[model samples]
Target chain A: MAPQSPSSARAALFDVDGTLVDSNYLHVRAWQRAFREIGHDVDAWRVHRAIGLDSSLLLESLLGDDADSLGDRAKDLHMTYYLGARDSMRPLAGARELVRELHGRGVQVVLATSASEEELDVLREVLSVDSCIAHTTSAADVDRAKPDPGVIRAAMDRSSTSGETAVMVGDAVWDAEAASRAGVTFVGLLSGGISRAELEAAGAEAVFEDAQDLLDRLDSSPLARLLSL
Target chain B: MAPQSPSSARAALFDVDGTLVDSNYLHVRAWQRAFREIGHDVDAWRVHRAIGLDSSLLLESLLGDDADSLGDRAKDLHMTYYLGARDSMRPLAGARELVRELHGRGVQVVLATSASEEELDVLREVLSVDSCIAHTTSAADVDRAKPDPGVIRAAMDRSSTSGETAVMVGDAVWDAEAASRAGVTFVGLLSGGISRAELEAAGAEAVFEDAQDLLDRLDSSPLARLLSL
Candidate 1:
């Protein structure tokens, strides 16, 4: 068989925090503050690497056996810190245009995140592109988070899309892992601050600089080809 | 941190079989043959998607618990069948030039693959760019194959390069996943027949249409920037 092209995609699943919004670094800071408040000091980059992971798995992957004892408290603390940090949250450049363009092209656009409903509301408020999204899957909708493939599956399911016709856009390794394991194509974006090499190694098919880069390349990008635009 | 540019790369780690040589389809066919000889039929894309996985993990991922019973037999069958399929193997377009170009640019080019020494010998013979590769790490050098990061680490170790100064180029998600976890930057090639989205999602900072496409853009490529040229 020849190399399969991007023409197979029909639905676009976007990982919100890092991919669409410039919140990954804030999440890293929040996690750090949360851990620090609990008398633990963790490296920022290590926290950055674990950004897209489900809160529980993120704690476990980073804390190892210690997670069992401290996960819940850290999660709560992080949430509190994040709520205050929300004011700094903003959609990445070209994010609104990219989503609106996908919608304009008749592609089903869905936001998939482990964020809670209230947090989702905040993000939606900032992006203000609610009308462009066809569906959304939040932490409450997914029993498991990324690296488990369950959230990706749930996101795809909500849009009635299959792996062959779906593409996941994320800024972290966890998002790529989820999309890869779920058999969906994963497109990586650098807007979230993840390195390209890290993103590629996680399983991105193609990567863009950010939402604007993707939007600018719509005519030449795999996403445009996938949408058959 | 901002999106990391590929300027940090000082050496290039290349995955041979599928990345440089056009052996990915042959792999899919071999697995299909081995599985079918056992009376089970799986999709070609399914087999293709699992190509870069370490052989042991490939079976476990594709066949689940049932692989525990049939793995040894399938392995034997695949080896037998692959020996015959080797005749069809060829280096991908510009594969040789890409290696030579990297070498000429003073970048340490190393071949990193899980292929056994014997299998790797066959691949090198066909690629015929032996002088371009500064180092090689076969399955013998690493206890864990790709997707485990050990092989990637071993290759980088031989060149005395750190993750920030190393880049991995391959055609599969497993290669990307391995590089991502190892903290190395990963560039992806489409010559292996994997989709761009899948490559990017797996964590490729960039994905070229093929080795030729990569060479064509070598002047402005991450590989060039990685070498500080």
Candidate 2:
């Protein structure tokens, strides 16, 4: 590829599950069932709050000491239950349009997610805007999942952009913390059932109702400011 | 029943679904599926926020004009999906113990829910502390659901308790609003995935992590204050 100019190097990193797709609650339910199958009864709301963490980290967080002995089985059970519910997944309102709009504005769109390679494929299919996506990072790309900032840095590296030239959009506190740690601007969406207050407290510079709301207010949003930069 | 002394007439009205039972996310999923089946494709988080509303009102709020054409069918679909997932329902930590503790304290425990009589039966079974429950009010007992205050008032009346002598515990903003309107103190629970800020803003006088946390802090809680009144 030819060398790109600095202005043309701007990028937008996206979180998939709860940000662009309606799958957070499914993950919560699956994890709840998985914990139960392993003889640990975890609450759904607890799992919901823990959704953006990597599966192993989530199991460890919810199961504590029991995670060592039951983690692998619970992880496998979660995968089975989650995959069984995969057919129900759908893109959030304007998810495809928002990504396409960002790409059309000359901003590279990178999917920065901790989802496994197989799960990423399904999510990409659901999003159906692969043509607009310039780069993607998955669990395979990083040693640590979100709230660790490794995945955000990896996505920025893959997109050939610096944190200053990119903005991260997600629906969970973990995503906000990760982006903040990576020195990137963070925008939050409430589509994940996390309240705006929680997201703002976690370091989101802007909060929207969902992909559609963000798209509707794109002109005044941080994404617009980043593009102007 | 014989007339009871005023001190023994203190009551606690409970919202069952997300407050005591770990079923809010299930309700969100079921509503999402129900809306999709009717071709609406509602977001899960939106359904989640609207969980405490009566089924008809929830449909109307989500579907708007489309609800006029699709309300009954969507309601039926939601019931079917929710009931199918009934076996997955479990009580939140200390749910049983909380009710029994209140009963042991001479506080009449009344389940004030907009859940159908049939659904309430299943929830009561999951809670398995019916003997500690002094009374219960369902959708059948009132023409309006939460945020209307009618159900809360009905529940208080059934328990022979005045607003000053009762407190409401729930996991939704609607519950807080209803309790506020009914002149009763409201205690919010985060087990419903609602943020503490949202609950407090909605008029919750106190907030707890869940039934367990409230039970752990009962001596300092509004429940104790009511008893002292």
Candidate 3:
């Protein structure tokens, strides 16, 4: 593998769950079941929109005042349910190819996700492009997750890249907000069940249908513009 | 219950799955599992977008050329998976109240959905507003489902309402299209994870966050205009 050029290198930071793996709905289901187990009957669509946030933030956003008392048990139940269904998780189309292509182009590719290290390992396995991942940042590395900029900043710092030369690809509004806060360009994908309009409202500069669509349009995409820069 | 005055009576038609009940993601999961069971790996987001269409149309839309061979088995598997998860389905906030309010105002309330009879029974149970629902059209009542206008028209017919006096509330683009085709006004909800822009582009005159938001703003919504008319 060729070393990234220090002076003019660009980086591609990605959110793993919905952005690369077809697991957002599974996460939604897990959270729904977890909430139900803890005597809270949260809606699935509500949980779907909360998938990319840090687990604690997710529980708070969904449970509100109840989160103070029920968050820990809900989080534990979520992990159990999520892991039980992990075998069905698959990579989004062109996920591995997109990562490989970015790495092959000498761009620093980092997995920037709010998933725990254990969960990240499973996601990486599903994505099956770890060799192309130059660096990664998990929930453990940050005190706050998206829409906090901490995770994005951590990924950029680990990749030794600046925001001007980095672009974040993600499937949630939280990812767009995090990228915006971190001064990185945001590219959104609709594969996470988030709408393009919502993504744009959250500051996405460009939007694609999914990983395959992004890969197909890479030459004309924001990533391509970054590569040219 | 008082009979609706034909001279000024209006109707409110509703799409069941994502519009009233929080089951779109569950339907996405069911479709995903069903496809996998039949040796096809359809993405959940893809299934999510196809939720409001008829089963055959959904299979065709997702599987294309292979749908001819695998559609029936996939449909059966989908029913089994969906039924298994039906217990978790819950009505969106204010779903029943919205129906009851409309019905109490002397407006005809119709449950217009592409769901099968059995599935509709489960959804109706979840919403628990059957008394307010004067009529309903399941898949058995229509040869073709939404995006084809058959189901919406069936609901209108059953309610003894004309397009000019009725409004269709839904959470998917297909519902917008079907309402447009049926010549009924379309109101959109964001509860299904579809974007407002997409719904508006599909011909929704107004959009709300969910059933709760719509109910909260009923006096200022398109439904209010129909009430006055």
Per-prediction TM-score to the true structure, in the order listed: 0.49, 0.97, 0.96
Of the true interface contacts, each candidate retains a share of 0.00, 0.83, 0.74
Cα error of candidate 3 at position B85, Å: 1.2
C-alpha RMSD of each candidate structure in angstroms = 22.6, 1.8, 1.6
What is the docking quality class of candidate 3? medium
Q: How many backbone clashes does candidate 1 have?
A: 28
DockQ of 3: 0.74
- Per-residue CA lDDT of model 2 for A1-229, tens digit only, reads 2125755688889999999999998898888888888889888888999999876688788999988898999988888898888899999988999998888778889999989898899999989988899999998998889899999999989878887788999999999999999999999999988999999999999999999999999999999975665
User: Rank by lDDT, descending?
Assistant: 2, 3, 1
After TM-score superposition, what is the CA distance of residue A185 in candidate 2 from its true location, in Å? 0.5
Model number with the top TM-score: 2
Model 2 alpha-carbon drift over 4 Å, by segment: A1-7, B1-7
Point out the higher-scoring one by lDDT: 2 or 3. 2
lDDT of 3 by residue, B89-191 (tens): 8898888889888888777888998688898889988888778888888888888888999988898888777888889999999999999999999999988
Candidate 1 C-alpha lDDT tens digits along A72-124: 99999998888887765667778899998888777888898878998898989
TM-score of chain B of 3: 0.96
lDDT of 2 by residue, B1-229 (tens): 2225755678889999999999998899888888888899988999999999877788889999998889999888888999899899999988989988888777888999988988999999999998889899998988989889999999999988877888999999999999999999999999998989999999998999999999999999989876565
DockQ of each: 0.01, 0.89, 0.74
Name the regions of candidate 1 deviating beyond 4 angstroms: A1-9, B1-229
Per-candidate local distance difference test: 0.79, 0.90, 0.88
